[model samples]
Target: MELKPIKTRKIYEEIVERIREFITSGELQPGDRLPSERDMAERLQVSRASVREAFSALEMLGLLEIRTGEGTYIRQVNIESVMSSLTWVLYMEKDAVLELLEVRKILEVQVAALAAQRANPEDLQNIEEALKQMYQDLQKVRLGEHADERFHFAIAQATHNKILIHLMSALSDTMERTLKVSRSKLYEGKDMPERLYKEHALIYEAIRQQEPSEASERMFAHLAGVEASYLV
Candidate 1:
């Protein structure tokens, strides 16, 4: 996790990765101010533009809090900030949010499938409780969505795979804000809770049945509907 200087063929990207590693490894902690832009360029032995672009990328991820005339500091970690910025990735002017959704489909469908096969009795109980909370909060659609998000997050934690959890966490953070925004715009303001409750119930049942494939399908199907309803 040491922030080595960029050495790869794609120099700029390597620089970006190294900078990320610095924060990841605690070489730079939250609220820890970074050396000046010029200092970073000189220390990393890269052009100033490279440091600027890398810092910009990190700032967008909420890794670095930049203040005019004050300097840049490591910001506290938050996931949705990362994902929201990732949503803007465009290739040749074509929207890649759909591709991002597909990636989420792959990761989360597998997460649900794993939760079905591997989730402990306690995990099942927790998920059910979360579902119940969601059901009760249906009258408060925003509350329901919050509970719903927690229910799925519980499933991810149940897997007990630290690396997988970290990876999914990053991905989840990226879409979380958008998800909330879209939910408010499309569902919370209307009759969206019923459908959401139904969808969560379907997934919950499949997990309770310990049917990994069924659980995965339910999750994927739910996400597909969500994408069509919101991100698309």
Candidate 2:
């Protein structure tokens, strides 16, 4: 029932959207072959180049499969790929990295509070291990970025929320890049990494003691420090 007549400069993009809608509306199904580019162009009254570009973009988005000597088929979409693409899109937006930190503060502050209440012995042990690794990495004159990430992820694991875990995982790559940028700036001052380690220690202790309020406060302070460091 939706119209697909091209009216804009970005004809290919509109074509892509129409195809996506078709798939979403159950008009198209996985493994169903699509009309050839020439045929589609003729049907839509658009250039073959526009149709080809549309198909190519859809393929990149994991929406379509184009096989030689065959035809285009709707591929089984992977939600992870869609999530990754969205992250990349956000990464390219203006002030997007800073926006990412704001989002991190929202998710991680609550995550810390929940972790404090929900963590079992094994979860606590994992959190402790990550903190210890941070210290060890610093002693070895390394940045310990991986350890820092593990520390946050360990807290998320303690929350026992599968959806939260997956959301965190989806954003982890972009978050790591943002963290590296922030850490580089923060580490320029004397003893800054040491100070950061202390902050982590405080957060770990709060969670270890199962103090939800303290854990949340410490997590908020830590991220605020990170933002101040990078944005300043």
Q: What are the per-residue Cα lDDT tens digits for candidate 1 across 62-89?
A: 7778899999988887655544334323
Q: Write the per-residue lDDT of candidate 2 for residues 1-232, one digit (tens) a residue.
A: 3445677887987888789879879998889999998889878889999999999988887888999899898998677556655554555453677788788888999999999999999999999999999899889877777888899999999999976776676567777655666666566567877888899899989998999999999999998988887877
Query: With candidate 1 superimposed using the best TM-score fit, by how many Å does residue 113's alpha carbon deviate from the native?
Result: 1.1
Candidate 2 local lDDT, residue 69: 92
Q: List the residue pairs that clash in candidate 2.
A: none
For every candidate in turn, the CA RMSD to the true structure comes to 7.7, 3.8
Scored against the true structure, residue 5 in model 2 reaches a CA lDDT of 60
Question: Lowest summed-lDDT stretch of 10 residues in model 1?
Answer: 84-93
